[model samples]
Target: METVIITGGTGLVGTALTNQLLERGYKVIILTRQPEKGTNKAVSYARWDIEQQTLDISALQQADYIVHLAGANVGDKRWTTARKQEIIDSRTKSSELIFKALQTNPNKVKKVISASATGYYGITKDHPFTETDPPADDYLGTTSVAWEKSIAQVISLDKKLVIFRTGMVLSKDGGALKEFYKPLRFGFATILGSGDQYISWIHIQDLVRLYFNAIVNDRLEGIYNAVAPNPVTHKELVLAMAHAAKGRSYVTSYVPAFALKLALGEMSIEVLKSVNASSRKIQDTGFQFSYPTVQEAMEQLFK
Candidate 1:
């Protein structure tokens, strides 16, 4: 079995991906700030601190692959200048640390799979974005550009690199769906802006499977959008969540952009922005999505 090193092993996606990798018989190693906190019998933990720029290079010395998922939570706070810097630095610095570690060590690590986001496309209101689309010029776009570029340094070391531009992941435990549904538990779900903005989402299971696929499938390289085939409008997404939660089908009220801006600051734009991403590139590689539609994905999540 191949040994794989994964950063961000404590996150929602990381936790799910670690279990899946372990179940598939891969020797999983997790990089964490606190090694003692990671108690997975199937996973070996190593210490890494992004702020201090320290890593256990010995962990990568024999790993077959590295999955870079370490980053500060984007939606965790309002996007103040300081908070925005934290987001950008957390992503780029972590990727730089990983790349440098890999380069300094004469390791057998052959491939590196890093995390990006559909936020790379910025606030697109019209066209559905593909991996081939040029990155946007906004804050999220610039951050993703720098984040992805930081990983490109690993490619220079002759490591085959794959970047997963992820979408809003839907899971029963956590993620945007949980945040979206939490408000609905109070008997009302408010749609931001016009509610016509498209939301591209995927099941957590599908995303984990996609990461695993990137590990084994040598043909998978470059940037691939990790999203479902069918995208939903904000209105449809709220209704689907309500349907999933067995809530009454009430009218979806709009939260005006001005209010969202005042409330969430710069983060409000992310909440209100329209982004429809295409996952055809990854699906073309013979990888099947378990939840291709929002309705189906939400149903599975709610179940």
Candidate 2:
């Protein structure tokens, strides 16, 4: 069995991906800040501090693949000046650390798959974004652009590099969907701005499958939008969640743009803006989505 080294293995996506990899017979090693916390028999943990640039060199010795998912939570707090720096530094420094580790011990890993986000596109009106679409001009966009660029350094090592430009991931356990529904359970849902802003989302299961596909398929390189084929508006998504919860809930009113701006600052655009992403790149790579529509996905989660 091949060995895969994963960073941020305790996160929502990382936890799911680690289980899937282990189930499929891959030996998993996770780069964690707390090595003692990783008790799973299938997983071995290594300690690394990106800020200090310290890593256990042995961790990369037999890594067949490296899945980079380490980063500070974006929506966990308001994007203050320090918080913004934390987000950017966490991503860039972690990637740089990984790349440096690879450089120190060349040919240890076969491929490096790093995490990017749909925030790369920032706030767009209605233009459907593709891999070729230029990144938007916003704080999130700058953060994502810098995040991806930091990982691009690994390409010089001649290893296969795949970047997943993920969208809003819908899952019952955690992520934006659960938070979005928590408010609806009180019998009302608030739409941000016009609520017509398109939200490109992918089921957690599908996103993990995409990662596996990229790992096994050698042809999968460069960037791919990890989003559903049918993107829905903010209103449509909130309504679907309310329906799934079977709550007597309705979108009462729009949260004005100014209010969001005042509340979230630079992060407000992430919630108030729209970007319909095209998934043709991944589809053309021969990956079939298990859940294509928001209704089907929500049904599975809610049922």
Candidate 3:
């Protein structure tokens, strides 16, 4: 059986992808920071301390593909200077560690697929960002660029490389939806800022499916925006979820821009930034989204 090594194999995306791969009869190896807690016999685990920059070389040797999902959650904490450094290192440094393992060890690994973000385009008010556009000169863009560049070692080693610039992923379990759902469960929706900033979102199912496609479809290389083509303004997304909830006394209101700025400080730029990314490149590969629109995505999540 072909083995796939995934870094950060316990995060939201990693956990879901692990099940999908195992169900398909693929050997899934998780490169984790806490190997002692890994109990699933169906999958294997290798311990790696990113902070210490160490890895189990066998994890690199036994893989046909590498899915690099290891990254700090940018929204989990306020974007202090230290937190910013952690976000960049979690991605780039982990990538460097994987590359180092491959350098020192004899391995037959063929492909390296890494996670990236739509933040590569910076905070644009209008124009939808495409893969062909140049990187934005901002913190998010710089970090994403560095993260992507760190994987150059894979391509340099003559392996297939795929990098996906993902947008906000909507999952019923957790992530952006969880944050949005809490307020909605109380019969109200809190829209951020002017609430007109475009939100490029994809269902968690679609996002994971895209990763599957990247592994199986050799043609999908370089960078592709992993977002639903039907990007909506923030207000539209909030109301759509409220409608989907089918709950009593549903009310949608804007949380003033000043309040969000005050509360989030530097991190507020993420929520208030407009992101309109296109998924045309991925779709051209004959890929179809299970949830192409927010209403469809929300309906399924609520169901």
The model with the greater lDDT, 1 or 3, is: 3
After superposition, the stretches of candidate 2 with alpha carbons farther than 4 Å from their true spots are 247-253
Output the worst ten-in-a-row residue range by lDDT, candidate 3. Answer: 245-254
Model 3: how large is the Cα RMSD against the reference? Answer: 1.2
TM-score of each: 0.96, 0.96, 0.97
lDDT winner: 2
Stretches of candidate 3 exceeding 4 Å from the true structure: none
Candidate 2, RMSD to the unseen true structure: 1.5
Q: Rank by TM-score, highest first.
A: 3, 1, 2
Angstrom error at residue 2, model 1: 1.4
User: Which regions of candidate 1 deviate over 4 angstroms?
Assistant: 247-251
Clashing pairs in 2: none
The residue-by-residue lDDT of candidate 1 on 175-221, one tens digit each, is: 77777776677767778788888888888999999999999999889
Whole-model alpha-carbon lDDT for candidate 2: 0.89
